[model samples]
Target chain A: MNNAVLLQSVRFIVLVLLQVTLLNTINLSQYINPYLYILFIITFPISDKDNRLLFIFLSFLLGLSVDLFSDSGGAHAAASVLIGYLRKPYMRFSFGVSYQQQGQKIAQSPFSQRLIYISLMILTHHLTLFFIESFSFANMMYVIQKTLLSSILTLVLILFSISMFKKKQ
Target chain B: MRQIIIFIVRNKNFLLFLLLFCFSLGITIHSHIFHRSTFINSANFISGGVYGTVTNISDYFSLKTYNNRLIDENIRLREELLKNGISEIDSTVTSSTDSTTNYVLHRAEVYKNSYKAPKNYLLINKGSHQGIKEDMGVITSGGIIGIVENTSANYAVVQSVLNTNSQINASLKNTNHFGTLSWNEKKDYRKVQLTDIPKQANIKIGDTIITGGMSSIFPKGILVGTVEKFTFNQSGNAYIIDVKLNNDMTNVGYVYIIENKDKNEIEQLLETTENE
Candidate 1:
């Protein structure tokens, strides 16, 4: 009915399609697979009303769709929901409590603040995802290596894409 | 009741997060069990159909490579026929042997193949409707792929050899020194590890590895890979081998699902033996 709802819905469909069809198929290297779909969660618009609950539910669906395509069970859902629940607090932490009063536009934020926000969220998402998917303490070091390498790639890609889109706007 | 309702409304988001988090964790744990099938996988109707459509377009790009592989395979088969001294005019097929007679092959196209994850799986187009079932072995003309974990009506999910949970019976091609072939998180898709090989067997780099057929799924002597390197596992009683797989797992397309006709009979016999 409205531009925001339409944009978010279009984003949801496009990101899921890109993830399953294009990005998931890119085996650049085993350690460097970029999870660009989480960009949808990261850049979801902040509003005046507290819709944290709705955001978390949407992210759960997002992650569940990915797991369905990838056959990864629910690891993505668990990680996405965890990050979704924490995103508000993360926003407050990175951009200060006055962010809500300032209309919390992530694109308008300082480069350092945006970097901290995206990197922290991506690292947490990757750590939880790899640990849950591996589900083994015996392979802790290996899992850590995979998490770090994949997070770096995801970070670079997300940041580069965000800046590219920002310039276009 | 008024006070409880107010409290519930206050913390509803946290409560919902907890509920969904636990539900997802339960599914993850259930999926880790090797035998039991879980609700979430790509072998279902929606995911399978999506992958099938995607691959249909992408398959054209790789048509040249697949054609080359088919040509190579045809040459190999012709050579083998010549070696057996069989003439094309003699319409009789090669005489059936115990090893080859019981195994039936069904061809399927892989709709999706994943080797990046530690617990990877493959989705194929054939399923129960095509006589495919769980525990059947999947292979390309070049080498092994995986075992069918479960099948939907029109699709099947295969637990790939690249997965950490995969363990299949494998041995050296020249000898019967059996070992358990598996993958670890440390290795890439091209390499898998073979463990429990006895210390006495003469081994070398590039030694051919093949399926042991000790299990009911794959027949004996199906090509697996070659020994990339090896070392004695801890305690020094046996060898831990690194096998370089023959298949480039990331590029799999068409595959053959091997159905061992005697799998049920063999499993039942083994079950009775264990019970006794």
Candidate 2:
């Protein structure tokens, strides 16, 4: 396999392990369970934009693995696939023509640009996950609080991990 | 055929996303408490094995607390034995010999639990092999926990009272006025909502709530919760009451699976009556 595929495979395994064994156990508060696994999809190579099928499949697999361990049924899988579907549009929207022309790695982007990209991706992911898990809009405030807090926590962790292990592009 | 192929190739990405998204949503719906999700629950082999191992490890660290809970339950049982005699204490065991006994309780340990979700479910170690079946009422010493939703060969999944779909027949301790007991999906695990009580029913804060026994699943007087607060609904004809659950749903360790002895017979009679 090529370097990108190999690297993504390793990241998938590592993130799933971290999520199930470590992160999922850390229930800081009822509403603040940080889901750091979505970072796998967040940092997935944008060069693979043409290979949408592979991207969606990998996202589904990643989410199903986490759901199996966490026993959350398919909430994660649904949310992850949604993020995977929207990733290209979001990147285009955030970075505009520069993203398409340069094919720049999102992690290597300027801090402000990267922040918007990661925050929106994480927010969409967390909102879908919490909503599907609840399957109801009855407790609107509770859902909003969970989505906001978890998105912030996930975004921070993803940003930190990206900075710490950023490739020398 | 060329035109069809072109169309397929043009929108392949959107089509694939729709397919997978719907697949995942189907899974979510199937696993919901409202659906009779007998399969694909967390009690399946792989997930159950992982959770069981994790619970086993955690159970060791909480041995002291577990032991204390068992001791407390034992004391309560002994007190009941002393006060009500062996027949009542052994109600779960003596149902075969005594025709009057309506419910039998079997002990099971929790394998996994989730309270943070809007629709929480509990995995218990007992299953069909242990005489546990779907729709059987489950409880701890403190009060009602939930009803068994599905069971495998060696495990069962409980639809916790914390779930939005849970609706149990519950009544006031002092009066016959009863309502449907359900959860508001709030973060707090200690509270549930009781609705449909008529406005004229004299209910006060701290008034006890228990199983109405109108249904065959739970016996009469099984403690459910206590009325915490109440308000008149928009119609002004019924009251919606907030109930404080007696059991801490998040901390349940051991539970009792209640099997109503005459459920099948009663259900059959009802079916016949309806048919007639």
Candidate 3:
């Protein structure tokens, strides 16, 4: 009912739409497709200590949505869940819990920290996704080429999105 | 019962999120199993709606280049008209009474495409209504795209050469040594795996490969790709030739569907033998 939730939902719809359609079309070369939708999972409010569950749930959805949209191999699901599973540790590492009301407060995903973690997550996610999608140990050079190119574009978009959120906040 | 009801009502949002997440997982898990699933279909329907809107916005930016391509093709045709003395009405349906000449044309556009997977499929704009049918060879101006896999009233899904299931009978155009074109889940070279080729074949790095005449799906002499590398796979008798496809499926917009006149007869014979 609140404006914030409504706006977030609208943006989520927009990101999901763009992710499946426009960005999906931009193959950039066979291997260099940039997935810009991971931004949504990275920005979800840390609900509680069980935010891990939420992140796991959402990351799986995000990756699966991408897998469905991009016709990505099941790797997107596995990778997204991997990142989701890892988010709790990374968030704790980034936004240390020694501060006031750490237990009482759901750690806010800070903008800069969100960028760093998202960048790492996207990099690992895409690399694993592409590598597994390729399913070749011999094609390392080619897979690396795809991973680096896609990571660059993903990071740029992630940075731009974080900055935009910062501006609004 | 009242206490339990109160407990559920108190934590409804958590329950709601859990329910939705479970539903999404169920849908995704079932999507790949069958040709159709309501959940996958719903995802397709929703994703399709969203994709359409976004494509419309971005396709606007592509108009200039698209127009230029059309204009250039038009000018080239006009030049041919000047030299050969042709009529404007016969632009698309080109013909000559000369039996030696062979040309067929049918318009199709890509509706669904994939490049991320090793073996990708492309859904095209033409179908049975437009005379497009399964195994009708599809190609772009640059080179081979794929063979029509399945068809509906107005569309067909092309078994893109990138697909893991694709096994086009192809070979070196220069030497005429042929093999089967296939993919191995690697996105690179989408151009991977030309199997059943003889190890003794005169294949070289950069040798151009084309569909062999032995196929009913594609006419001979249509380009497949250039050989990037070759080696003996588990099957020692056959060489595993890596090929780099010529037509870039990533940006393929328009294509032409080629139907062989004798395709029906060939398929019928193959089917009977298959049943036997």
Candidate 4:
């Protein structure tokens, strides 16, 4: 019913579609899976209407769509849901929202906290992703290599998309 | 119902989050396997569409490169068509096969190509839809590029000869000296050291390296590169010649996948002897 919630869901759907159809197919190599769709969840405002439940739900949908096209549905789910779950503690910790003021969602998240949250989530998601995809300790160096490369690329895209769409307040 | 709604509202955020999170996890675990891989597959198809759309936007500049490749390929094929009268079976190449070869030519455009990596590969625009198959040798006007690594209906990947791990038999045109062409990972020059070249054989820096055609992967005399530096390795049984590739693997745009007329037979023969 909320304007922001509806728009965010639409954005999430659009990101999932873009990620699966266009972005996923851009296999720069056997590795380097770019995760641009995380932008949807990252940009979702922390409001009463759009709470943690919506975050996880939308994240799962986006991730599942990507993983299917990506040939690893569980992979994106694990990462997306992890991002979703951690978003709460992450928001609480970095945003400096007091425990008593928990229900007060920040309409315009500060750039510093947003950067930190996005970086940690992106790092976390990519680490789990490439590790599970490579699935071998034997490929220790390569797995790490893939993780770093994909994360950097995905991070750049996430930052670009969020800044482009988010209204400055 | 009123009490339950009140309780749920009190913890709506947490409960809703958990439920959605769990639901997504359930779908994910199931979708990972082939049993429910259709979802992921559909997702891939959707992603493929999106990729196609985005490429369309950025394809303007790349179009120049793509057009240049097409022109080059067109000229080569047309010239052959004129001299061979479109029926002489490409006399530029001579085969030892007992029967007339039935070579089929397929057009493929390189989509994603990389040579910076140790094991380099290229993804082409053509796939099973364009009659591409696994192990089909891909080439360009320059020379032998690589072999098909994977294939879908719309796209396929080629294992580039520039890859460090790539091994193909080649010989010096002048002295009949032979060795393997391997990537020198340290340099962008793509100097392939022709190993096992008879120590006594004459090899000059300007000498040419061509496919020996000892194997079916590539035809004979397709230029691999030219000797940049020639010397005996630690083991003097061969001359380790540094070959400078003529076709820059990094700039590959348009490629012609050479389908050996007798590839199946060649494969069969090799497979039979592999056990021995």
Candidate 5:
């Protein structure tokens, strides 16, 4: 239990630092900006012992930290909290009955299930973030374009990182 | 009371989510609608310090290009000096004392720059300590960059010209047909739109656009852009012209902050007149 807490804390700090310092500065193009920090929320432990309230708060802080560096107001915090609250239901839908078991290990989950779960999280996060940032329906096309392209880029980075850091049994 | 407590316990998660979400939305709305609270931005100490340190390292790599730009600017200024026959040094000094035009320029380095966002901003290393303040104009050797929106002790945020919220006074090179300069809904850093020019202004593609100096923020006749394209609005009374900006906003590394000594006086006069 102590180890789990330490791991999550370390992940939080590392991801936020990587995001604000490195990923935020990489302007691949006007349409695509990969937010790899969302990986912290996506890979957070899902055991029954986990405190959901604490998770939501941590997610808000994570996004707020990014917002501070990016000058994005609170759009990131809102998106992250929304996803943080929805993560349980999303886990149930994607991971099925296994999500209800004690100490569910997401790493051991089937590949297709992980992909579905990650895609849903990234898509929801990007949609909420881009819409709120734009804050208008007049440029719906531009917002949608940005959301889709940015989500794809973020999804690829998340998946690549996951595969690269997969634990050896 | 026990039943109410149970109900509250049952819905605590939803309530917490709603509470946090509302708080965030309030911040977003507040920042989007009006001037933001200066504390919650990159200009604050920790993030500002990080950006400053990182830029200190990265700036070393771009010194050559920056040096060349400075040389080019020096040559241009010398040519202008010779043409105007000013044998003595120009009175536009950077000191606290007033010059003839009363505009003082301070040099600053861009620590962080972003052009992809709809509302983009640049963070500079200088701030209140360096005599920088909100609403002062920032320009590079190429052209205008932005206006300072906020400042901390050692850093400041400049709202870039590419932002959707930005609108500046601009006009034809030598003509008095001024209009509002702004960005289009489309995301293009290289181009901005100039609107509200009367139909009889005789505009054409490739015509030069310069700052109108109607506002105290920017002086008259600074080069802004060239006419890239032009067309009539729906009513056909004014031209909606596209301008290709002179400054490459994405490549900006250094800027000059322009402070007008008469800004407070001008604003006070306008306020008193309005109350009459």
Candidate 6:
């Protein structure tokens, strides 16, 4: 019904499609699969009046869609929800009270603040996804390496996409 | 009632988060325990269909490589045919002998393959309708591939040798000593491990490994790998040999599913003997 809602909806569809069709198939190496779909949750607009329940619900659906196409069972969904649940706190910690009081979207924040927000979000998501998928600590170093490499790739892709698409606001 | 309502409203978001998180974790646990839960079944169907289409498009790009492999295999087969003579091969085919004729081979293409995971699986384009069943041995002309684990109407999932739980009977080509073949869960796609060979068995680097024929699944002397390294285990009674597989599990495209004709009868007889 509104411009923001329409744009966000389009973004969700495009990100999921890109992830399953192209990003999931790109096996640069065993440990460096780039998960660009987390871009949706990382950039999801948050404000005091934003409905936390709706945010997480949408995150779950977005993840399930990717998992359905990638055949990862529910690992993506769980990780997405975990990040979604933590998004509010992480945003507050990264942006501080002034940005919240001004009701600024994360994309409009300072470069350093945005970097911290995206990196933390991507790292948390990748760690949760990899660990739950492995479900073991036997390969702790392997898991950590994968988490780090994939997070870096995801962060780079998210930043590039934001730079290309997000209009200065 | 008033206090309860206030508390619920105050913590509703956290409660909802917990609920959804548990629901997803439940799905994960269910799929892991059952291995073929409804969630996985539907997910597999959707993902398999999409991957099949994607592969169809991408397969053209690799046609040259695939064609080269096929030509090589064809030349080797023709050489064998010429050396052994047509009649000898024909007689073995017509008669049920232990040599090659006892098993019928069906050709299938690898539709989806994963070598990076600890529990890797391969999806092939043949299934029950094509006479494929569980425990049938799958191989490429290069060497062993995996075993058929589950089948749908027109698709089958293979538990690859790269998987943690995979164990196949393998033996050294030059000797009678045999061992169990498995994976070390290492990141390399080209190597697997062979364990349980007796320490007394003389083993050398580059010794060929092949199927032992002791199991109903794979026949005797099918090429598997070569001994890359060997060492005595801490027990000092057995050797652990690292094998470099001939079939590159990462790049496998064409495979043959070996169906032993007398597998059912043999299994039944063995069961009866055990009962006695």
Candidate 5 segments exceeding 4 Å error:
A102-104, B36-38, B86-100
Give the C-alpha miss distance for residue B75 in model 3, angstroms: 9.5
Query: Candidate 2 vs candidate 6: which has greater lDDT?
Result: 2
DockQ, structure candidate 3: 0.24
Compared with the true structure, what per-residue lDDT tens digits does model 6 show for residues A71-106? 455788999988999998888889886667887766
- Higher-scoring candidate on lDDT, 3 or 6: 6
- lDDT, each prediction: 0.89, 0.84, 0.67, 0.68, 0.86, 0.82
Alpha-carbon runs more than 4 Å astray in model 6: A2-10, B1-8, B36-38, B41-44
B164-187, model 1: which lDDT tens digit per residue?
888999999887999999998678
For each candidate in turn, give its C-alpha RMSD to the true structure in angstroms: 1.9, 3.2, 6.3, 7.6, 2.6, 2.8
Which pairs in model 5 have colliding backbones?
none
Q: Output per-candidate TM-scores for chain A, rounded to 2 decimals.
A: 0.94, 0.94, 0.78, 0.80, 0.93, 0.94
lDDT of 2 by residue, B122-146 (tens): 8898888888899999988888999
| TM-score for chain B of all predictions | 0.95, 0.89, 0.68, 0.69, 0.92, 0.88
Docking class of 1: high
What is the Å distance of residue B256 in model 1 from its true position? 0.2
Order of all candidates by TM-score, from best down to worst? Answer: 1, 5, 6, 2, 3, 4
What lDDT tens digits, residue by residue, belong to model 4 across residues A66-120? 6544444356776777687677777667777662255533335567776777788
Model 1: residue A4 alpha-carbon error in angstroms: 2.2
Q: Candidate 4 i-RMS (Å)?
A: 7.2
| Candidate 5 C-alpha lDDT tens digits along B1-276 | 999999988888788888998888888888888754645678988788888888888888889989999999999999988987774565564356534358899999898888877788899989999899899999999888889998999999999988888999999985789999988647477889999999989987889999999999999878898999998999999999999999887678999999998999999999999999
True contacts kept of 3: 0.15
Candidate with the greatest TM-score versus the true structure: 1
Provide all candidates' interface root-mean-square deviations: 0.9, 2.0, 5.8, 7.2, 1.2, 2.3
Docking class of 5: medium
Score residue A113 of candidate 1 by CA lDDT.
98
- Residue B99, model 1, lDDT: 63
DockQ of each: 0.80, 0.57, 0.24, 0.31, 0.70, 0.51
Task: Specify the poorest-scoring 10-residue window by lDDT in model 5 chain A.
Answer: A97-106
